[model samples]
Target chain A: MTRDSSSTLPAPPALFDTAVVAGVGLIGGSVALGLRQRLLARRVIGLDASPEVLREALALGVVDEIQTAPGEWLRAADLVVLAAPMRALAPLARDLAPFLNPHALVTDVGSVKGGIAAEMERLGVRSFVAGHPMAGSERGGVTHARAALLENAVWVLTPTDHTPLTALSRARTLVESLGGAPVVMPPDAHDALVATISHLPYLASLAMTHMVARDERLSLLAAGGFRDLTRVASGDPRMSRDMVVENKGALREALARFRRQLERLEADLDEPDELLAAALEGKRTRDSLPIVKRSLLPQRHDLVVAVPDRPNQLGAVTQTLGAHGVNIKDIEVLAIREDGGAVRLGLESPEDVQRAAGILAAEGFEVRGRS
Target chain B: MTRDSSSTLPAPPALFDTAVVAGVGLIGGSVALGLRQRLLARRVIGLDASPEVLREALALGVVDEIQTAPGEWLRAADLVVLAAPMRALAPLARDLAPFLNPHALVTDVGSVKGGIAAEMERLGVRSFVAGHPMAGSERGGVTHARAALLENAVWVLTPTDHTPLTALSRARTLVESLGGAPVVMPPDAHDALVATISHLPYLASLAMTHMVARDERLSLLAAGGFRDLTRVASGDPRMSRDMVVENKGALREALARFRRQLERLEADLDEPDELLAAALEGKRTRDSLPIVKRSLLPQRHDLVVAVPDRPNQLGAVTQTLGAHGVNIKDIEVLAIREDGGAVRLGLESPEDVQRAAGILAAEGFEVRGRS
Candidate 1:
C-alpha cells in the first residue's frame, strides 16, 4: 500500500445492503435484475403472492431471496420497489409498511401516478416515491424481464410533500445507477403531461380508425400513412381503458385543447402559406423527436440496396454483409415493389458501407448511397 | 407442314401498340416502365417539359422514346397517360387532344380526381379516364421508378359521363395487365373516400403534433405511441398542403365527423365499458385492415429469438438463416433492452421455423416459438 499511492483508495460499499421488489412481473423482475447487475445492492429479494413466480425469479437469478408475503425480513431491506398492478398497489403498500425499515427508500413502477400517489401518502409508507417508468412491451411476465429494460428509459418520479428530500435524492441516484433518466414532477402534473403525450394521441388514432372503418370504400383505400397514423389503435383495449379512465379529468382537458388545435388547422386550409408553415413546423418537431434522433445512431451511414422482391431476398442481403464482417446497425424496407424493393442498411462507418456495397454488387444486387 | 397446337394458336396483340407517359416522375416513369416490362405496349414514349428529364428517362430505359413537348407523333399513340401535376393536367390534355388518335384512351394518374375530372370533361379530351393508382413513394424521379410499383395496387378509375364505356373497359383491362386491381368509381366519390381515408388522418396527425409541440414537457414525454400517431405529419409539407387544399370541402366534412367521434369517446371515459367497447371495435377494424392482412404473409410462422442488444445482431440472425437456406419472410424487433432485445422472425413454413429454431439454438441463441 505504501509503494503505490492509487492502492490507498478505499472501496465504496454497495448503495443498499438489501433491496426488495413486489410483483415479480416484467417491471418488478427487471428492477431486481438491474439492482443485482449494477452491484447497487448486496442482496435482492422478490416478494410475490405467487410462489411459482418467486421460484421462477430465483431460478432466473433475478433475486437472491424470495418471500411469499411481507414479514420481518422486510425490516432488513434498505430499499423497496412496488411493481404490482395498480389495484394491488394500495393493499401491498399497506401490508409492507409495518415491516419496512425506518430508513428504507420506497418507490413504485406504475403507469399512472395520481391515484396511487394519494393512496401511498394516506398509507404513510416509509419515505415513498411514486415512479412511472416510460417503458413496456405488448408481452409481459417474469420470463420476458430484462435488466436493460430501464436503460435510457425516462423514469418519472413524483415525490409528495410527505417524502423526505433525502429519499428523493436517493431514488434519483438509484434510477441513474440503473441507467435511467429521472424526471421529477408532481403526481397531478405527471398525469396531465401523459394525458397530452399519450392518452390524447391514442384517442385521436382510435377515432381516425373507427371513422375509416365505418365506410368500406374508405377502409379499402387506406394506405401506409393511414396505417402509421392508427398503429396505436390496435393496442390492448382493457389496458388502454384502465390507463385513460384513471386520468380522465386531465385527458378531457387535453382533448379540448386538441379540438381547438384541429379547428385552427381546418381554418388554415384557406391560407395555403399558414397551412404549409404548420406542416413544416410539425415536420421539424417530428424530425427532432428524441426517439427518431436516438434511432439515427451516431457514426452510421445508410446504403440502399435494391433486392428482387422475392422470398429471402432481405435475408440474402443481410447474410452477405454478415459474411463479410460488416455490421448493419439498423435496417429498414424503404420501398416495396413486387419485382424488387429497396432495403436501407445502416452501417457503423463509411468503410462498412463501401464494403457492403461492393459485396452486394458482386452478389448481383444493385446498391446506392441513401440520398 | 403440320404445326404444334400451341404454335398454331393465334397470338394476342399488345394492349397498346404505342403508349405515351407525360411528366416523367415516379408515377409516370413507373407507368412507362410497367408498359414496357409487361409488354402491354410495343412502344413506350416519355414526354416532359424538361429535356434533361426526358434524356434521363430514355437513358434509364424507362421509355423507348423521349419528347420534350407534345408533338405530331401523339397521333400514333394508342394510349396517353397525363401524369403531369394537378395544375398542368388540363393544359396538357387540351394540347394533346388536337394530335391524339381518335381511339387513343387518355388517362391520368392524379391523386385529386374531381378537379381534373371536371377539366377533362370541359376540355373534351378523347376517351378520358381519370385514374389514381393508390401507390406511391416519398422519393420520386425516373431513377427510382420500378415496373412492379403498380403490382397488386388498387388503381382507382374515375370514369365520368364523358368517359366512353369502351375506354373504361380498356383502362380496366390495361390496369389488370399491369398487375393492378381496378376499382371503378365517380371522381367526386373518389375524392370523398380519400378525404376520409387519407386527408383526415393526415390532418389529425398534424394537429396532434402541433398540440404536443406547444408544450415542452409534453414533447419531452412523447414516446412511441405519439410517434406512431403523428408520423404522417412529417411528410412533405408542400405536397400535403396541395392535396388537402384541393380537397378542402370533402376534408372539412370528414373532420366534422371525426370531431363527433372524439366527443363520443370523451363522454365514454366515465363509462369504462363503453370505452373498452370502442377500443375493442377499433382494434378489430385495425386488425382486419388490408395492410396488416397483407403483411401477415401466408404460411409464415413467427419465432422469437433472444439477442444481445448490440450492432449486427439482426444481421447475424438473418445471415444465419440465409446461410442455411431458410428464408425469412419478415423480421421485426419486438422489444429493445440495453443488455439484450427480442426479435420476431417470420419463416415461410413450419418446417422453416423448426430448421431456423435449431440453427439459432445451435449458435447459442435462446429461441422460442411465438406464443
Candidate 2:
C-alpha cells in the first residue's frame, strides 16, 4: 500500500516484521540490538561494507543474521534503517531502492538531514524518514553498542515538504518505542540548530586541542584545564572530518562567526565592558541548560548534606531517598576540606525534597535545605 | 634579620607571624583561610578595595582581620600574597612597596607572569615571587573559598632574573605548606606556556559560548554539548577579561596560531587525510594528561567496582577504602545502565588495591582492573 501524500494524519501500520540495518557500526548496531530488545521487529538483519564488522556484529548478537548487500536482505525488510556515515547514506539509499519491499518504511541515523533527505528523493526512494539520534561515543563500533544508548536521548527528525505521512508516523512510533524523545523540525532548521549545538563544539574542541598539540611545553604538560576542554577531541576523527565536510557551508560560516566574536573579545580586552558581559552572558546561557534537564523530571529542588569523610555516606543517603520513592535529579560530592565533603542532591521537586530530607535526617544524616 | 641568599638550601625559618592577603576573593580568601588552617601564621589579615567583600571575608572567618587598604597591614606582614586580578597586581605591589617591611616576602597568584614581573620590577617591588595556582572554581567569592582549595594543586612560580632568592625560598616554602606542589620557570617561559594552555582554552570557550549566545534559539536550547565545552565561560568575566588584556601579546599570538590551524582544517575538509591525523593526534594529546594526575598520587593504582543503580554505592566505596587506610586518588561513579553503575576508584598504591578490592568484593562488589 502506498502512503497518501495529501493526508495530514498518518495511518498507523503494523509493527515491522523484518528490519535491515545498514553500516552496523555504533549507531546501526544499537538500532539492530534495540529493535530486538524492544521486540519491535521479529528479525533484525545487519549489513555492512566491512566484513570484519559484519562478523563482529553477528558474534556480538546485535543482529539475528548478516547480509553483505541490499539483494540479500532489503526485499524482505518492512523497515530499513540507514545508519551509515553521512557520505555513505545516499549511495546506500540508491542500492536499496531497487530491492526495497513495497510496504517498507525507511529511516536514517545520519547527523545532517537536509542534504540526505534531498539525496534520497533524487534517487527516487519512497517512504523515507530522515532522523538523527543525538547520542554517540568516542569509541565507535558494534562492541561499544548498547541496546539502551538511545534511551532518553533526543532523536531529531527532519521532514521536507515532499515527505510521506505514513512513514513519519512509523518513524515517530519506532523512536518512542525505542525510548527516545522525537523532535520534529524542518530539514534546514535541524541542520542549523545542530551545527550550533554539535558541530561547532567539535570545531572548538579541535581548535583547543590543536593549540595544545602544536606547543612543545603545553603538549608535554597537558594538564586538567586542557583535558576538560578537549574531551570532544577524542571523538572519531574521520567521522568528525566527514561531518564538517558534509555541512561545510554551515560549519564554515559558524567558524567564521565564532572567529569574529573572538576577535571582538580580543579587541575589547583593553577596555572590557563588552567582553565582560559576553563572558557572563555565556555563563548564564550555560546555567540555563541544567534547568531544562531538571524540567524533564517532575520539578527540581536541591539539598546539600554534610557527610563525613567515610565510606557509604553517599550510599546511605541514596538508600534513604530511594526507600521514599524519591529519585535524585542530580548529585555532586564536593570535598570542602581535607576531612569532610558535602553531598549535594538535586531532588525531583520541592515536595519530594522535604520527605527525602526527613528520611535522611531521621537516619542520622546532616541534611541542609528546607525545600 | 635578612634572609641568607648564598645558601643552596633555604633554612626554612618560622613560617610566618603575620600574613596579609589582598583581594579577599576566591584565591585571596582561600590563601587567608589556608594560612590559618595550616597554622603557618599567627594572624592572617585580609585587604580588599571593596569593603563589602572584605566584610564577607571577615564574616566567613577567612581572615582574622580586614583592611580597606594595605597601609594598616603591610608593614607588619611577614608574608603577603597578592591575589588580586591581573590589572590590580602592579598597582597593589606599588602601593605595598611604600609601606612594605624589607623582611616581608611578596608573591602573587596572577595567571600571566611576565608582564606582572616586569611591572613589579618597574615599581622596584623586590622580594617578589610571581605565582599562579592552576586551580579555581566557576563559583567565586569569600563564601565559596575553602582552606583546602590549593591542596595538592600545581602552583606555577615565575622567578625572573631580578627576583630575590629569599622571596623564591619563602614562596616555595609557603606553597608546600599550603599543600601545593611548586614548579619554577622563567617569567617569559611561564607567559608563553600559559598562553597556550590557560589563555587559549578560555578564548576557545568564549568563541563557542559567544556563537551559541548570539543565536536566540540556540542559546535557549543549548544542551549537553554546549554545556561541557563552554564551562570556562562561566568563570568570573572580569578576571578573564583582565587575563586576556594583561597577556594580550602572547595570547594574541596563540589565538592567531589556532586560527591558522582552523583555516587549514577548513581548507582540507573535502580531502581530509591530513586533518584526520591532526584530530586523532589531538585525542592522543588529551588522553595523556591523566597520567600527570596519577603521578601526583603516592603510588598509583586504580580499581573499578560494579554497584547497583541505587544510592550509597559511592559512600560505601569511599568508606571501605578509608577504613582500609587507602586514600582515594580519584573517584568517578559512572552509570552505564538504568539498573546499575560502576565505581572507578584510583587508590593510593598498588599495595592498597588488593586489600581495597578484597574488602569491596567481600561486600558483594564486582571488582575489575590490573592496578
Candidate 3:
C-alpha cells in the first residue's frame, strides 16, 4: 500500500474505499452520517466495544456495517477515525497498529489533541491528524447523528511535522465539504487553546454546579442566571472528566488566573464608589454588544412588502405582489393573529414595493412597508 | 409622624410620607420608581453622592425629588432604602443615624445581607430588613430602571430578632406589591446561600474571562459558549467586587468546593472510563431540564409555533389568534427569514390553540400544531 504524501491534497478515490469509525456515539455517528451522506466511501463500517451500542448504530442507520473484531476492522479499512474517549485513544491505537491499513490516514475528534497526537506517533501512526469539530449541543447519542451538525462550524485540524501533506489536505477537504471552516494549528498549540476555551469553561461550570449542590438554599433560589452559568455542567461527566484530567495543567493555569481576577474584584468591593463605577463601565460595555454579531455576508437589497395585522391580509398582499410582475425573493410574516397580521415580502428591486402596494390596495387587503 | 403597628394592615399614609432611596442607580431607581408606580409612597426622594446620577435619576423620573445631603434626606424619610454598594452601606448607615426618622424602616438591596444588617444595627437602626431582589439584567443605570423590574422575581428578605414585625410585614407587602416572591431567611443563611449561587458564579465567570484574555488565540476562538460562560464577568466590576469582598468567607468556601470538583474531574479525566461515564450521566440529566421552572403561581401558557417558509404568515396567524379572542401576553419571534419563521406566543391557556388555528385557516395560512 502506498501512502499519499501531500497533506493538503484531496483523498484519492481509493483512499476511503473502506473507512472504519472507532466509536458509534454522537460525534462518531455524525461523522459516519456525514461521510455516507456525501458518498465519501464505498463502505463505512463501525467498530465499537459495546455490542449494544454497535447494534443501535446499525439500527439507527449510523453505519452500514459493524465489525465485531477490532483487528479485523482495522485490517480492512483504508481510513480510520478514532472517536473514542480521550484516554481510550492510546490503548486502542496501540492494539490496532499491527493490523492497521498501512496507508490509511488516521484522525481523531478528541478535544485534547496534543496527548492523542503524541500517543498516535508513539504507536507509529505519524501520519495521523488530530481534529476537533467545534459543534455540539448539551445532548449526545447515535440517534442524534445529523449531516448538518458541522455546517458553518469551526473544525480545528492539528498537524505535526510528521503529518503527510496529502493526509492533511484530504482531511481539510473532507471537513470543508461537510460545511466546516477548517482552522489549522500545531497539536500542542491546539491543545492549549482548547483547554483555555473549552476545557476550562467546562471545569468552571462543573465547579459552579458542585458549589450550588453543596448549598440547599442557593440551589433552590437559583434562577435563570445560575441555570445559564451551570448549563454546561449537565454535559456527560465522563467526557468532562476525561477533558479535565487530560488537560489538567492548562485548566489549573486558567483557574489560577480566574482566582486572581476574583481577588481583584474582591478588593474593589471594599471601595463603594470605585466598585459602582467599575460596574457601570461593565454595564456600558455589555449593553453595547450587539445581540447577534452581524453575518459575514451582505444584506440583499429587495423591495419588501409587509401585511398589516388583520385577517385575510396575506392572500391579498401575495396576489398584489404577484400581479405587479415583481419576483418575490423572500416573504416573511412578522406576526400572525386571529383577526389579522403582517407579512413582509422581499422583491428583487426597491421599485417593486410601490407597484406591489398599488396591486395589493386593489385586492382589498391592508398592506404596509416592510417591517 | 405616626407609624402603624398593625402588621396585617396596609401601611398608613404617613408611613412612607418621605421615602428616601440611597445610591439612586439601577436598583435604587427601580425601587423609587416601583414605590411611585404602586402609589406606596407620598414622596420618593433620591440620595446619591454623585450629582450627575442624582440629576439623571430626577430627569428619568426615577425619583420625585433629589437631596444633596444624605443626612437631610434620611431625617425626612419614613422608609429608607439603602440601594448603595455593600461596602458603602456600613458608613452611610453611620452618617444617616443622626438624621434618621426615629421610626424609619431601613433596608437595602445589597447581595451580602449579614454584614450590612450588622452595620445598620450598629448605627442604631432598630427596625431594618436586609433584602436582595434576585432581579436584574447584566445592565445598570437609572436609565435601566423599570417599575416592573421586580415583578414576579424572587426577593429575599433577611430580618433579625430586632426587626419590628410591623416593619418586616410592611417590607413583605412592598415586595409583593412590586410583583416579587418574598423568600424570608436569616441574614447569615442568606449571605452564605448567595455566596454559593450568585457571588461564586460571578467570580468563576470573571476567572474564565481572565483566562481567555490571557490567551490571544483562545480568546479569538471564543464563541457563544465562552461568551455565555463569561457573561457575568462583563457585569459591573464594582458590584462583583463588593460581592466577593463582603462575602469572602462564604465565597471562598464555594470556590474551594468548586476547585475540589475540578480536581475530581481532573482525576476522572486521568482515569477515563469511570469518570467519562459519570460526566455523560450528568449531561443527560441537565439536557432534560425544563426550559423554565413552573412558577409558584399560575404562569402564562406559551406555545412555540413553527411555521413553514412563507410570506405574511405571522400577520395571518396573529390576526387569526386575535380574532378568536386570544390575548397575546407576550410574543417572541424566535427565527425570521425571507421565506418563513417560528414565533412563540404567551397565551392565557392551552385551549387558545384550537381557536388560533381556525383563525389562521380562514386567513389562507397553512397553520400547524403548536410546537
Candidate 4:
C-alpha cells in the first residue's frame, strides 16, 4: 500500500518537462493530464495526423504544445510516448529513430507487444521498450481523458533479449510513478497471452453484434443482456480491426478451441438421458471449481437463519443487521412467504453470525445454522 | 404514465383460477411475487423437483402452496409456466401431458424456444406458448427474486398457428402486469433471433472467459475491458449449459460467421497498410454512429469547451456558467499544464452553448464547441 520512493531515480527534469505524446487522444491525453497533476512534467507536447483532433487536443489543453512534425518533437522531448494506432507502430518508430534523444526512453501504449517489437526492430529504434497500460474505456479520444484513469491499473512492459536493463528499469519506474503495477514479459508470450484475453474477445463480441444486426427484429428486441455482450463490439472499429488482423493466428487458434467447447455441449443436448447424467456432472464440476483450485476464494460465505415470508422480509433483515453494526455480507433467502422462511446470510466473520442471529430472534424471528 | 384501471379485468372463479409456476427459482419466484403484488392471480401454486426448494418456496410466501407431485400440480392449475432447465422442457411436458387441465394455457421462460416447442408438441401441449423475459442478472436462485425485476424489460412470446387468441391475450396481460413490453413472433424465428442476440452473446462471453482462464498471468492482468466482455460468462453454469445445448444449431451458425470475420481480419493483418486503413475505417464508422443513428440520442447535449492551458481557468469558467443560471451538467479537464489547457462544460441544451460560450469569452477564457 505504500509508495516506493527509495529508487533514487532522478525527479523528472521539471513538473511538466516537455512530454511528447504521439497520437494524443484518450490514453495519451490522460497521460499528459496525469503528468501535469503529479508535477511529473512541465509541458506536454502532442503529435497527431488529424488537424481537427490536434485543434481539439490543443483546445482541450490535452497538450501544451502541438507538433506537426514527429522528428522535431522527438528531438526536444525528454520522454516520448507513442499512443497512435497499433498498425502505425513501424512508421512511427522509424520517424522517431533518427531524432530520438540519446537518453530518451521511447515506449508505446499499444495492446499487442510482439507486433510492436517487430515494427520497432524494422524501424531500428533499438532503444525503444514496448509498454502497454492495461487501462481504457469503451469511449475514445482526448475528450474522454482523465488524470487518474491509470491509477492502480496494471501497466505491462514487454522487452526483448537485446533491450538494455537500464531502459527496462526506467520504464518500470515510470509505470510505478503513475501508480500502476508493472508486469514484465517477453514479446511473443505477451502477444499470445493478449490474443487469448483481449484480441479474441473483441472479435467474438463483433461477431455476436453483427449476428444480431442481421436480424433487424431481434436487434430491436435486444435488452441489457445483448447490450452488455456486444458493448465491446461498439468500440473503435479501427482498433478492433487492427487487433483481430494483427493477432490472427492466435485468435484463430483460440476460436477453434472455443468451437470445440460448443460442439461438446451440443452433443450433450442431442441425447438428454445420457447427457443428463453428464450435465449434472458438469454442474457439479462447475460447482467444485473453487475446491479444485485452492487458490480461488469463495465469492461469499455461508450462514443459515429464518425470517418471515412477508413482503420485504429480506430487506428488513438487512436493515436490522445494518442498524446493529453487523454487516450481512451476502444473503440468500432460501424460502419466504407471509408465514416463515429460511435465509442464508453470508458474513465477514463467524462471530458476527451469533450477534446477527440474536438480533433477529429478539425481533420475534426464528434463527438457525445453515446445516 | 397512469395505469388504466378501466381496463383491469375481473378475477376468474377461485376453482378455475390458479397460477402455475414451473421450476420455481429466481425468475419464477419473481413472477410469483409480481402476480401477488399486482393481484394478478387468485392463487399461486409452485412446482419444483426438490422438496427442500418447495418447502422454502412456501415458507417464503413465494407460492400459496407447493405441489411436490408434478402431475397433481399441472392438472389443477389454469395457467402453467415452464421455468425449468431448457433440457427439462421435453421431459417435463411429457410428464404433465396426461395431467394438464384441459383448458389450461402453458407458457415458459426458457431462453430458447424452438427446442422447447418441439418438446411441448411431443407432450401433447398444443396450447403452450414459449417466452423469454430479457431481464436477469448474473445471480440466480429463488433467493435473488425481486418483484420488480421484469419492469421495463422486453418479454418475448413465441406462438404457433394453433395458439388460441384467448391464451395469447392472457399471456400478454400477465406480461404487461409485470411491467414488461411484449413482443410476439413465431417459434423458429424467436430461436434464430435469440441465437444472434442472446444465446450467441453468452457463448462469446464464455469463450472469452475461458480464453482468459487458460493464461493465469494474463487473467490476473485483466482490467475493465476483460471484465466487461466476460461478465455474462459468470452466469449460472447449469443454465448456461442448457442454453448452449438447446440452441446449438443457431449458435453454431453464429460461431461460424464469427470465425469468418476473424479470418478476414487475419488476412488483412499480414498487410500493415491495409490493416491500418481498416482500423481507421472502423474508427470513423464507430465515431460516426452517434451522428448517423439520429434515434440513438447522445447522453449529453451540453458542450464540453476545452479551456486554454492556464491555472484557475476551470474555476473562472464554472463561476461564469453559474452566474448565468446555466447548470453545469458535467465538467472535464481534457488536459492541463503550467502554460494553458481546455475545460469542457456540459450544458442542458445545444441552445445553452451560445450563452455559455459568450460568458466564458467575457471571462477571458477561450471556449470551444461541444464534444
**TM-score for chain B of all predictions:** 0.75, 0.73, 0.72, 0.68
Off by over 4 Å in 4: A1-19, A41-66, A70-76, A248-371, B1-16, B70-76, B264-371
Q: Please provide, for model 3 over B1-371, each residue's C-alpha lDDT reduced to its tens digit, 9 standing for 90 to 100.
A: 11122322222232256888988877889888888865557799999898999989888878889886765546667888988777688887787778888788788898888888888778778878889988786678888988667766678999998889888987886776555778999998887788776777776665555555555556546765666766776766666776777887777676667667766766665566756664664455444433433353455454545455545556755766776688888775544444445565767776775666555545444433322
True contacts kept of each: 0.77, 0.62, 0.46, 0.31
In terms of lDDT, model 1 sits at 0.81
Q: Write the per-residue lDDT of candidate 4 for residues A1-371, one digit (tens) a residue.
A: 12132322222133224678888888988887776654456688888877888898888867788887766557767788999888786677777778888677788998888887877777666667899887787678889987667765667899998788988987886775554667899977777777776776666665555454445565566655556655566676667777677677776676677667555544655765544444444333323233211123233334455554446756777787888899777665443443555566878775787788787766655565321
The sequence of per-residue lDDT tens digits that candidate 2 reaches over residues B1-371 is 12222423211123687899988888888888888765567789888899899888878888998889767557899888898888888888888878878788888998888887887788787888899887787678888999667876778899988888878987887886676778899987878787887788888787777776667667544666567777777777778878877787888888888788778777777667877777788777776656553245354355767666556766877786687677888875433455555555877777778888887766666675441
Q: In DockQ terms, which candidate is top?
A: 1
Against the true structure, whose TM-score is highest?
1
In candidate 3, position A98 carries an lDDT of 79
Better of 1 and 4 by TM-score: 1
DockQ-based ranking:
1, 2, 3, 4
Judge the docking of candidate 3 as incorrect, acceptable, medium or high: acceptable
C-alpha lDDT score of every prediction, in listed order: 0.81, 0.75, 0.69, 0.67
Please give me the DockQ of candidate 1 compared with the native complex.
Answer: 0.38
lDDT of 1 by residue, A137-246 (tens): 76788999997677667889999877899999999978866657788999999999888888888898888888877886677767677877777788878878888988
lDDT by residue (tens digit), candidate 1, B1-371: 12122322122245688999999998999999888875568799999999999989999999999888787999999899999876577788888877888889889998889988887677767488899988887787788988767766788999987788999988987776565778899988999888988888888878878877888667777867787777778777888888899889899999989999999999999888999999999988877776731232233366767776556777888888888899888786554545666676877887888899998877766676632
Q: Could you tell me the lDDT of residue A114 within candidate 2? A: 80
User: Which 10 consecutive positions of candidate 3 chain A have the poorest summed lDDT?
Assistant: A1-10
Model 2 DockQ class: acceptable
- Model 4, first chain, TM-score of 0.67
| Model 4 lDDT per residue over B272-314, tens place | 6775564554433333333211123333444444444434546
Q: For this target, which candidate reaches the highest lDDT against the unseen true structure?
A: 1
